[model samples]
Target chain A: MSEADPVLLNPEVARPYLDRGGDLPALPLGPEGLDRHTRRDLLKEEMAIAKEFHGGAMWPYAVAAFSCFAVWLAFFPLAIMGELNLTVGFVLSCIFATGGYVTSHEAMHSNIGRPGEKNRWLNEAVGAVSTIPIVFPFSMARMMHLEHHYHCNDPVKDPDYTDEAPNALWAWYKTWYNRQPGVDGSIHHYKRILAGMGTPEAARALKETMLLQLVFMAVLFTMAWSGYAIEAGLLWWLPRHIGLSYIRFYLSWAPHHPREGKTGRYEQANIFKSRLGHVLSMGMETHMIHHLYPGIPNHRTRKAYLALKPVLQQRGVDCSAL
Target chain B: MQAAVRGLFSWMPLLFGIGFIAPLIAQIMQRLDIPAPAGISPILFGLLIGAPWGLLTVVRGRWL
Candidate 1:
């Protein structure tokens, strides 16, 4: 294939690079009149398997989340008794939180059971227990997340890919604020989200969190009043918000950064497959695959991701670690 | 700058207090062979354990 073919430097490949605040380079499309291979076909088989795997794994993920929740509550009063220290409680709590989040994520994708009412109820119930209310339903997240996959590198369209001017400015302001005070700027960013005074999505999430917090406060307030309040405020509330905000920020950015001067859908896929690609991404890492096939479950994503790695690389797509 | 410095200074006590007190308490509990207390209700137990654990796990899994 000669380097002069226009297809090689198609608009889809070039547009994202330009959006990442870079100069546009002249891309040479490979050899004229060359037959393009069926790109989607390459992933067809893997995509099918990915869907199947996600379907089966969703229930197990839900059960795991519920179990973690049970364990967390059983051990929580120890905080009041001063039997369990903050760090240990914090660490153990984090483990349970992760399990819950993973279960919710699977439910969001309908990976826990059949994609119907049963799955929705399970997702919402699990979500409520995890402190993410059913108000921000899995259906809503799935829809937005699908958009994120569809326009992975498009700075304007992908809700998750926020390179918008105002957002960027806020991010910059946040960094400066943290640096000036020797506090991690990221923490400030997180606190802002926890406040639930930002975007609509944030507001919705915050509402759910606040409701849960209120219930938590009531319980703590009733239990030896002062002791419960102190433990709940110091250990439970602050840490949960901080931890949730931190993870959200990292996951939001990991999959769609610019690489090798490309920043469009294809390059985003490349990044998703390369830098952020991992077994744990649970199908999230195979961002390109997810974009192309949203119905595929997270559990099956690892296989699809690996299957397309070599082919994507050959097409001049570079996936680099962040 | 002064505010930053003061804030930093103030946090010293909080840091030391939490760091010292937490582990010390855990050690005492260990020595006494006391098991951590469970929540009063099943749902409460789930909330206490699930809520914090869920947040921590998600953060650790993603960041670490």
Candidate 2:
């Protein structure tokens, strides 16, 4: 190829960049992509294979945990020094930050590590660290996500979708967990699950969390108060919005928008056959697999999808439009 | 023309890092009492260097 030859935005090259770390964003299986009958059949037939893709690892969790810190660490000072342009540099930070969040989603599921406090602390820690760029509280997001999975799109129940999904970029526009109002801002749901905890201890922990938050905010506002307006815009506020938008774009808007209001195995999610789809969302392009088999981790969603695809298609699942 | 646009988008990170990031960093260094080896509006110098670097990197990343 000549120097000026056009470069195709092919899968192998583009997918990695879009996927950030190895975790692919989950693509919906196809809104209600699988009928309940078919879903049951799939479970009976392919659940074993999907199960093989389950379980978690440690080293990958460390990479994802530390990488999130590394990205913010690098982006902040550069942003502080004005070494980064607001548009491009902030976007870069968003990309890395989104990667951290994506992996952190798995951490929420304990897919990248142990679950149920065997790995709960690690999971929550990674999630908390990852959200720094976005300024969301990790514990709150985790509890909300657990509900999101339980209700999926149950109107008035799944805190995420109280109203009808707008006839628009519906999925992408759904409110984030902690970003919304009128819920447990301090992760009371999970705390409730933590049994036998006395009131005084709970009060103490809550007091500390609030204090830490107050101090953190005081420092940021102090800096911004002192004419780091552009710096704050570039590093903090801008990247937080960008990172959240990026995730919603790939995870919510792209997959859910196409097929909202569909029911069972046919819910408002779909699989994208295009490399760009896979590239943009990672394995999330196979979202149905994750929804149906939440136990399957990020790296394994695709593998399970490929494994069950034949069975799914045989039962009239929509695998068309690639 | 299309290639150029895509190239430009792909290369923004590099471009901004040089033009915007570099200059601000210089100013920050000066604020921290670091030696500049001379006097200057490091921000302006940074912009001058970064803009060209950003543009060229965009081209290289996209095409080559």
Candidate 3:
């Protein structure tokens, strides 16, 4: 099949099992325990498939960054001439943040260029421009993130999992204070992330966050002393927060929560099921496919995900909505 | 659905005012014996409350 076949490329049309739901069958745990060589070959095949979607041309990163900067410039007048249009400013900031974030994201995966010293410097530069520097040390984030991929939804281990603790008083408070009757539980769950970030692990994350903040502050101060601080903050600082917050919110939670029959952590659910999910998340919405094959790059995931959905469903896994 | 809409309308304003507003509202709602809904965060709550204020600023010609 051609690489760009609609059926192959689109998860929505290819994976019907997510929408047509019933109980899934159990996944095979290496039938009869194959020999080492056979298993190695299978793994190699999987890795090859995963690598097929690896790396996009670097131009998208430049394009995204420039577009984001233009948008921020357009909004600069609103922040300067008007009375702190918090909403528009905030929304605009979010856009900036997302741009910064996406660039940083590409850098993390070394998608901007070849791997090594050159790539490292470029990645760090991109990350610095994004205003979230500490996350640039991909070795650290990759270590944590890889663990997250391996044990997604494992409450105790997954950095992304923010479900309530069963026995904790804090958990009780969360349920009482946040759990609304009818709306999707995303807001409550997201609150848990915000609150949880205050915890020890989050404190660690914050330390890393602060390092970047310090660098950002220095830049701001330099601009201010140069008599261009207000312009700099408008052009850079303010918009960065807006974009980052929106992108973080948009990217982080939507793929996981609001699914049916999902309960405690370790439920092994794929929550991105709709066309909206795919579009809004920039194709990250084929979540079940992601969990099944974490090595698959973002671009090629939809097709691979769809190809495996039927098998995954037969194994009793809950595919996402779309 | 009506209850959902009512809850959203009520909460949206609170959420938008400040980043911490949602958590504060969630805290208060818990204390008042009111049912708090799920899936909302303090940040988003702040955005919700902030949106209208922004619109008002625009409407009043305060935003240039």
* A43-86: candidate 1 lDDT, tens digit per residue: 45444545553344466666766776676776567776778776
Which DockQ value does candidate 1 get? 0.04
Ranking by DockQ: 1, 3, 2
- By the DockQ metric, which is better: model 2 or model 3? 3
In terms of TM-score, the best-performing candidate is 2
lDDT of 2 by residue, A15-128 (tens): 654678664323212123333455566657877777787875655755766775786677656766777666776666666667767767876776655655566677667776
Per-residue alpha-carbon lDDT of candidate 3 for residues A1-322, written as tens digits (9 for 90 to 100): 2212233224543344346774322321222223334445555665565566555456566566556655655664555555556466656665565555556555555556545655556655554454342122333343345555655666555554543334334433333333332222323333234345466654454345434434555555454434343455555655654443344344445555532334433244454554446655666567555555544445567877666555444444566554
Off by over 4 Å in 3: A1-48, A66-90, A131-147, A163-208, A214-250, A258-271, A291-295, A310-316, B1-64
Error of 3 at A223 (Å): 11
Tens-digit lDDT string for candidate 3 (B1-64): 5356434434432333332333334434444556534666533543465456544533442321
Q: Which of the numbered candidates is closest to the native, going by highest lDDT?
A: 2
